[model samples]
Target: MTYLLEYSDYGSAGLLIPAGLVLIHLCALLSAFHSLQHVRTSQAAVAWVVGLVTLPYLALPLYWVFARNRFEGYREAIRDIGKEHDQSVTSIRRELFSEPCNQPRTFQSPLAQVATVMGTPVSQGNKYRLLIDGIAFFDTMLWQIQSAKRYVYASFYIIRDDQIGKRFADALIERANAGVTVRLLYDEVGCIRLSNRYLRRLTEAGVDVHSFNTRQGWVNRFQVNFRNHRKMIVVDGRVSIVGGLNVGDEYLGAIPSMSPWRDTSVQIEGSLTRKVQAVFAGDYYWAARADLPEADWQRKTDCGTTDSNDPSLQEEPSGLGAVCTTGPADERPRTSMMFSAAIGAAKERLWISTPYLVPDDAMIVALAMAKARGVDVRLLIPSVADLWAVYLAGFYYERKLAEIGVPVFRFTNGMLHQKCVLVDDSLTLIGSTNFDNRSLHLNFEVMVAIEDRAFICEVEKMLDRDFANAKRSNGSNRPLRPWFARAGTALARLFSPVL
Candidate 1:
């Protein structure tokens, strides 16, 4: 009553003033629904609500106005939402990052036959193998590209035109000239530093190329933030490759930029490669000019390999390496759910490697809980992060995780960009999705989950190398700063959700 009276006395405002606040609140509620209705599941919708309620009263909006308003990804969308007159920061900004955009055909449908021949696992016949470091991974990729007979589909968040990229491009062009259908997709923002002429050369060489959601205009700028971060390759519908590796010398450790880029990737055979192709084809159609036929092609060979006596192969498990894509197009991308499942299923240890470290609160809590359960949870991050604010946020979590007994390691080499999470000695997750709020809820991303023990073992081997080189962040290594740094960090934290 005192507050009401004070408001009334200050400006002689009438009862109608409260109605205005009520109206604004109502509008916020409605806008939140419209923003999140298209998401895949109820949990995502709930998250939208939670963010709307929690952020508007905080300083996040003011922080976002300065930080993300100028980013190429959010400019157009921000403008559109602002024009709505009642849009909140959360409603206007949060973007879902999941794999639903590349919806696959049913497992047992007629499409399964063609998809199976293309390396998509069908029913009970998937096989997966992991390649740990850039050396082995690069060699394997080169061998496969050289052996291609039909078509090649490749996509990556970053495709540098350095030694490794040039090598891959050369092999791809060589195969394209040999009558193989070659298509390549790269993220515009991820490749922003490279010259436009760089990709034009690929086009000139007859390799069909497209960029994911890239455009330059006043109205289409929202698409820029929705990057395709997946690194994948499907060869001739019989084999597929995916994980954290990108086409760069850093990834191969051939360039001196970083001491060694530690990463994980997998080779899959059986029917699952078709699913990868299906997702890639969706991206190709949406971003490129060509329209390939989606007709169900019968499998030319059985995806299952029952014989263990082949000279080039040995006995393995009977499970087909299923391709799982997570992105925003689904009712819920459920990438977080997939991670949760992997973390929960961990037996011995959980090893993670990521360039970025700003995860949502739930993810942090999940990690803490895992540590509490006696799971050996380790995180490998860059000692010198590209962005200082993001680096501080990483430091913020260091104290908490360390207290919980989760060991954190900082790579002594240059910046690490690969994002990977491995559990026990087998299960692994590799793709474009980061453990940050932006990648979890806003960006369009994809990842592949593998359960093969051999693949996990390879990932462990590579992780061991990274673990050795990483320097521990003792809570007291860097001197504590003055008030302004803490204030700046606080401000950054306000907009961390969008950052």
Candidate 2:
């Protein structure tokens, strides 16, 4: 009787263990269903549903880490803020640039679609200078900050607490101490390694500093996928800088292994600078919950009038440009639309350079169509990767694209960090946006579209030099990839919706 009783207890305990596991798996399936309803893409939703049903223990944790897409409360906050000051802001901006011929001619056909998507009208009477590398870019930027007379607004995705970071901070501090009304914004996730001491020093010197806090509300406590990836600096409402360079020693090419980091930036002066400043103002309000007082929000009485024969106006045609800013807060996917339109408009050639090349279905289709129609499509990606998983995943796409006659090249000189596109020989798009899902659907990004012939020629020459040094791939040259690496890439691709 005692032996039978002990056997009964063992059986009951074993049954309980199975029951608990069943319950846990049931919960995971329910979460997966929720994801299917909320995920941005059908591919991601189906992947999550299958993974959760088959491998709950592994998929559940990853889903929680990177599956969330909607930036909770951010869209509502932006709407509310705009409602509070929409008329005043719009009227003030109009009055500030109230001059004849300030409005650029509406772009025809496909480019017009991009203008509508961006919601910022193309402006005339703006000048631009392309900065090729980090050293020249930073030198010009620092000098402009030092020369600020009224105010300065600067934002970067990553601001490390290193040598270059200190130099940037010191420059801002000096301007702030001299009563320049300096404001700085950095991404909390991108600058995760930044020390509190570094920020405290800036605050002590009277420079207002804040992080682009995507985790500000309770509902967003676990939402770490969204990022502010824009790099912009506007000084005195007259000069602005925008591009891919971030604040760090790596950007300066100080690390020997990754030395000669290739990048691009642009400095702009004229009416378009105000538009950039306006974009900064919106982001600043989201970060600090306060308006930048020195921003030129009122009308100017001395706005320049159009004079075609004027020496100043005839000297150059670099003033034809538009600013496009997009993020998760937008009602639609503006960044993706912008890229698609640019690709569709390409008549002769489309050259692109980015560190990452993980394209979604829409972008892939766009590129394929461009190639089918005889658009000379070429892509430049880094031969050596800083992230192993990303590197492996890119191989899949590179092979697929090359099969369609889209020539892809790997930069053997060093890391190609420039996010730029040359559409034919008439337009150039440059900014912090990358050709990946993260930039397309989950980050705050800014891009400038320029249609100046002279500027495009200059950018073309620069890209030609880069292409001469890169190695062209025929798509059949991939080395033997291990089974484990192949598996890792397949898994990594499952998370590309948020990567």
Candidate 3:
């Protein structure tokens, strides 16, 4: 009778523990169901479902933290804000349409199609100078900021609270104190380590500062995957700078170990500057929920024109460019479509350079098709990556492309971080968007597509130099690894949907 009572008590206690576990699992299943409806990719949805149903204890929290697909409330907030500024957006659109590009007939159709997809038209009479490294980029950027007479709108993905960052902050503060309209936007996740003191200094100096908060509302409290990866600076509605370089001492090669940081940026003046400003305006409104002053749309008649004797106008009037801003807020996946379009349009040659090369199925197919059609395809990626998982994941895709006859080059010299695409000798795509899943579907990105033969040649020459320094590989060059190392890479590839 005693043994029977003891056994019954143990059984009841065990039941209580499993009953609680069952309830927790049931809740996890409910969350997994929610994920199935919102996850961006089918593969990701299935993965979450299986993991949640089988290993709910571990997968549930990860799903909540990192598996958010769409940016909840951001689109709605953008819509509401757009409705409030419908007049301004419409007016800007009208102005963009009024100033048509004088591009060659062969380039006009494709450019127009891209413009339609991006909702920003190609503008002509724009002067462009390619800044090869951080030194040139920051020097020119600081000069532009100092010369700001009306307003300065600046945005960056990573703004370190270091020496270089303080210089940038001081310049902006100086302009702000001088009564120029100055607004600064930084990504909260990218600047996660930024000190409060740094931002406080800017705010105290009368600079309008805001973070691109990915998790801003109740619905988005756990959604932290989306990021604003764009780096742009627009000064006085006349000069605009955009590219891969962020504000940091490392970017300037101040750190002896990470010296010789390879990056690219373009400085633009003329009609295209206004379009860049318009891009800034949208982001500003999204971050601050306040409307920026209407931009001055008056075109500089002598915009890209410079006297032959004048060295300052050396980069004048060389190309026509359009700004493409894309994010999850769009009803359609415009960035993916844009990449496909550029790839499909290439007939002669296609060259690409990006730090990350974990492309999606669509991109892989596009590249394969391009090769099938007899187009020369070349890809440049970092030989030594800063992110270990991303580096390993890149090898998986690199092997796939190499098996298909596409030559992949691993940059030998420092870390190559520039994002650029060259199609034939006409189209150049340069900006923050990388050839990866995260950039294509999740992050908010910007790219400037320029159609100009002269500029394209310069970019080609620059890339040729990069290719010369890089080691060409077709997977055979990759060193043999142990089973565990290979397995790690395969696992990283599996998570490419989120990476």
Candidate 4:
């Protein structure tokens, strides 16, 4: 009423001021209603509603950037691509699965064999092992890229324009020049600084390169909240390398601050590699809107392993592995479900390593439940701080988990950038997912769940070494941070749902 009186007492400009305020308030109310409908969790929805209703002036812009719970324009179509001789390519993005991808096979447009990442068929004789560090990961990845025969599909979150990036770009260019079909996908926000020269060289060499267009234009640039954070490279649809190492010199310990980068990637060779390529095909369709040149998807069940009764050779667990991909487009929060299900299935021990550990209430409860079941649950995070807000929020979570008797080990050897989870003695997960709301609820992410005892032993040995070098903090006897840092944590946690 006071605002109305002020507007009425003044001239036309004052009247417009009140109208603008009303418009802003109306937009906030609408966004609040959207939050109620779209936000995955009740806790996140209520937080947005309270802030939006109370502080529309400050909250509206932030809401525009971060509060969109779904990636609106992403598509799941697997086009029936032509052969390698096709001269041109065209693509169109569509929202095919308007709900949770429960019936993923129904998405088979004209390519029925092109599988979704929901649940790949388990097969035998697939050999999967870990690449322990950046050196091993890159050495194998680059060699495969250089030796591509039919096609190469590479997707990553970040591709820096440095020595590592040049070596990667040169490999793709060289392969393209040699008549190998090459497709490259990088996150738009992650490679926002990627120069035109770098991309131009690839295009000129006849390589199909596209950014995962999470953002449309500079006018709405902050819509970078959604990202395609998948790191995968498939050569001839036979070999796939999936994990955390990005195309950057820092990943190789070139930077003094982040020396000795610690990460892990898995290379699977056999029919299962086709599933990883399918994930790339779906993402490529969304970004490039064209069909990928067809490659061999023939199922071979007995290739990578020999049928032998010797004790040394008979210890394999049939190489059971399944792949799952998740993102904002799905109606249900699949990433959270994926993580919770893995946590629930751990009977003996569960070891998780992530650069970030900002879990939600449900995740806290999941950890508590795991501890109650006597599962040896441990979390490994980076001792160093990359993003202050996320790093600080981790302390708050560490304290909360400590209350439930779970301990966190901080890696001191280098930055712990691996998103890996080893469960008991048979299952392991590796890919480009962080344990935060953004990665679990918002980003387009991928992880291959391997359930082979042989592969699990490999992952266990790697994590054993990682844990051996880490510093353990129970968070019960001592403060994780000083009073000022603790105060910062309170503020940091306020943004965890969006972080």
lDDT against the true structure, per candidate, is 0.63, 0.81, 0.82, 0.78
Best-matching candidate per TM-score: 3
Ranking by lDDT: 3, 2, 4, 1
Task: Please give, for residues 141-202, the per-residue lDDT of candidate 4 as tens digits.
Answer: 99999988989999998998899899999999999989899999999888889998999988
lDDT of 1 by residue, 35-154 (tens): 465433465456556655555433223322222212242333334434542223222111111123222345332223222222323323567776766887889888888888888888
Q: Predictions ranked by TM-score, top down? A: 3, 2, 4, 1
Over 1-499, each residue of candidate 2 has an lDDT whose tens digit, in order, gives 9999999999999999999899879889898989879888787788889888999988887787688766677656545666776753553345322333443245553434455555556655667899998898889999999999989999999998999899999999999999889999999999999999999999999999999998777877777888999999999988999999999989888877777899999998877777788778777767876655567754222213344555655554445677888888777788888899889888899999988888998999999999999999999988877767677778778877877778789998887899999998777888999999889988999988887777889999999999998987646756557988778878877556666
> Which regions of candidate 3 deviate over 4 angstroms?
1-23, 91-110, 297-318, 475-484
lDDT of 4: 0.78
The model with the greater TM-score, 1 or 4, is: 4
Deviation from native of the Cα of residue 392 in model 2, angstroms? 1.7
Q: Give the TM-score of candidate 1.
A: 0.69
The local lDDT score (0 to 100) that residue 38 gets in candidate 1 is 43
- Candidate 2 error regions (>4 Å): 1-30, 54-58, 82-113, 298-318, 477-488
